[model samples]
Structures are given as C-alpha cells and as structure tokens.
Target: MKKFLIIAVMALSLGAYAQVDPTFEKEGDKVKATYFHANGEKSQEGYFLNEKLEGEWKMFNEKGEKIAMGNYENGVRTGTWLFWEGDVKSEVSFDNNRIASVSKAGKKDPVVSNK
Candidate 1:
C-alpha cells in the first residue's frame, strides 16, 4: 500500500507537470505554456513550452508587486531572477540553468530569534 501511494503521488505530480498549454505561441517558434496557477494574483504562475519555460515570467506578492522575473527553463529556475518591491529593487542573481546559487545584495544581516 505504501509503495502504491508513492507511485500515485509521483504520477499525479508528473501529470501536472506534463499538463502544458498546447496552443501557446512564441512569436516565431512553436513554443507552448501551461498556467500552473490561476488568476495570476496570489501564489505564482508558471509557463512551459517544449516542456520548458521560454519567455518572461513573473511571480508577484500578495500586494501585487513583482518579486521575481526573467527566463525559466523547464521546471527549474534558470537565468536571472530579479527581485523587486514595486519599483524598489531588492535582490538579483544569475542561475546556471539550474537552481543553485542565490546571491543577495551586499552584506548579510544578523538574525534575531525570539526564543
């Protein structure tokens, strides 16, 4: 039963990932995209084509401010991901076609725990 449950979960996850837009266009190329999220208000919206993200995508905050932007390949975060608060830019970094390094601006601030 446990093994069956694991397979079921994997299948469902893969299904959603495979559920991409079949009619999406990319100017000259025959790219596609699937809306992983709805309304594009909260959470985050994802686009996929050729089973990869081939255009500019945005992930906004609850206040409707863009927090991340840039190119995306497949399901992994690749290229530059610029973070901002409305017009107040925050952090930005480059990704090596895979989610790895994440560099912030300047010095790292100290953390305070309220134990």
Candidate 2:
C-alpha cells in the first residue's frame, strides 16, 4: 500500500506539471510567452529572445491577481521588481540577477523606486 500511494502521488505531480504549459507567440524580434496554472489561469507572462527570457514579466497568483512584476535582460533579472502581499508591497532592485536592495511599504505609504 505504501508503494502504491507513492506511485499515485508521483503520477499526480506529473499531471500537475503537465498542466502548466506555456504558450508562445511571435512578437517582432521577441516571442511573447504566457504560462498558465493548472486551473487555466495565467501564472506569468513575459517575452523571450532566442529562447531566453527577456523584457518585462508579470506574475499572477492562482486567483489571477498580479503578485509580482519585473524585467529581464538576456535571461537575467534586471532593474526593479514589485511584489504585492496583502496590504504591504515590496520593491526589490536587482543587479546581475541578485537582489541589490529591498524596501517595504504599506498600502497608504509611498513606494520609492530604486530604478
């Protein structure tokens, strides 16, 4: 019974991964890609250049709410990114795909851009 349960769990995991397929469309020199959750809601949308992540990317939660937005250059994260959680928002700056700094603000607080 333990082995059977393990197999069943593995099968379900594979099914979940399969459901998160991304759709791509050509956009001039870049390709716009949108990845969906298992429930068919958009999980993230962004652009690709030469099969690498490029340009702006926006991430959404399961409820289709925007959770994060950022930019990438040559598959590496660049510039500032915004992440929302409840009544708080975080601004993170990246340098060479590493977090350079981060600041949090309340809903009524003014957010300063690092970029």
Candidate 3:
C-alpha cells in the first residue's frame, strides 16, 4: 500500500510539472502570444506577424527572472539582444537572424549597429 501511494504521488508531481500550451490573441494584424513555464509562471511573451515571430520578445526562466530580451523582424532576429545569467550580462547583436557579435557588460548596453 505504501508503494502504491508513493507511485501515485510521483505521478501527480510529474503531472504538475507538465508545460501548458502557449496562448495567443489576435490584435489586428499581429498575434500576441504568451508562453508559460510548467510552474504556471510566465516564460515569455511576444507577437507574431503573418504566423512569423515579430516585434519585441521577452523571456524569463522558471524562477521568473528575465533571461533574454530582443526583437524579431519578420521572424528574423534583429537589433540588440540582452541576456542575463548570474552576475554576467551579455549583449548580442543580430542581423537577419545571424549573430553579428557579442559582448559582456555590467549595465544595459547600447544597441550595436551591424554596420
């Protein structure tokens, strides 16, 4: 009986960690999306244009800490992206979805032009 109870508890715990499907809302021509972690915490939010990722996107970890932020132009990564891990912050530049360069800084760094 104890073994059966333990198995049931484990199943419940696994179910609790199952990720929820992302939600989408249509706003004019853009579709706003919100994705959540298995813990029911928001993991990311962004917009889609013509079924393609577009506009500003922000991501957070399961602990609800901002992990990355950047922009996608017509599904292609563009502009500057910022990532955080521990005490280190990384700046990544992208052009047409290709990484142009990356740098580390203590504070929010300015956007690096691909030119």
Candidate 4:
C-alpha cells in the first residue's frame, strides 16, 4: 500500500511540470500560433508557414507585458528585433540570421541608431 501511494504521488507531481500545448489557427497560407504559460497567460505569438516560423513574433512575460518583438523568415531570425527590460530598450538587427548591429537606449536617453 505504501509503495502504491508513493507511485501515485510521483505521477501526480509529474503532471505539474507538463507543458501546455499551443493553439493554432489557420490564416490564409500561414498559421497563427499562440503559446501559453503554465498560468494560462500568453507567452508568445507568431505565424508559421509550412511548419516553419515566419513573419512577426512577439513574446511577453507572465504578466502579459511585451518583453520582445522580432521577425523570422523561413524559420530563421531576420530583420530588427527589440527587447525591453525595465527602463532600458535594446534594438538588434539581423542579416541572414546573424547579428548585424545592436543599440540600446534608456527612458531618459536619446534613441541610438543601430550600428
């Protein structure tokens, strides 16, 4: 009986670590996917083409605050991406999925162009 009780407890505990599946919706040639946090808040959202990541994607914290925004093409990161943390904001540019340039600015600072 004790062994059965321990096994049951372990099985229930494993369920807590399980990942929630993302929801997908069809949109023309692309599919929009919205992934969720364990708490049911939106974690990230984006579009996929031919099962590969495509177009703009946005990520958010558990509280639903946008933390990062970027674009992907053919499953590869492309174009400019922005990240926000507290009062600071970072801009990153990509070329062929490689970092091309990066710049940062603060709430009280001037907007710096990517270098």
Best by TM-score: 3
- Candidates 3 and 4 compared: the better one by TM-score is 3
Clashing residue pairs, backbone N/CA/C < 3 A, model 2: none
Native-to-model Cα distance after best TM-score fit, residue 56 in candidate 4, in Å: 0.4
TM-score of each: 0.41, 0.77, 0.84, 0.78
| CA lDDT, every model vs. true structure | 0.58, 0.93, 0.94, 0.94
User: Model 1, 44-103: lDDT tens per residue?
Assistant: 455566665656677666565567777765555666677765445544445666555565
Residue 99 of model 4, lDDT score: 94
* Cα lDDT of model 2 by residue, 1-115, tens digit: 9999999999999887777678989989999999998888999999999888999999999899999999999999999999999889999999999999999998884578676
lDDT of 4 by residue, 1-115 (tens): 9999999999988877668899999999999999998767899999999999999999999899999999999999998999999899999999999999999998885578676
Q: Determine the C-alpha RMSD for candidate 4 after optimal superposition of all C-alphas.
A: 6.3
Worst 10 contiguous positions by lDDT, candidate 4? 106-115
Error of 4 at 5 (Å): 13
User: Each candidate's root-mean-square deviation in Å?
Assistant: 10.0, 7.1, 7.4, 6.3
Candidate 3: stretches off by over 4 Å: 107-115
- The lDDT leader among the candidates is 4
Error of 2 at 107 (Å): 0.9
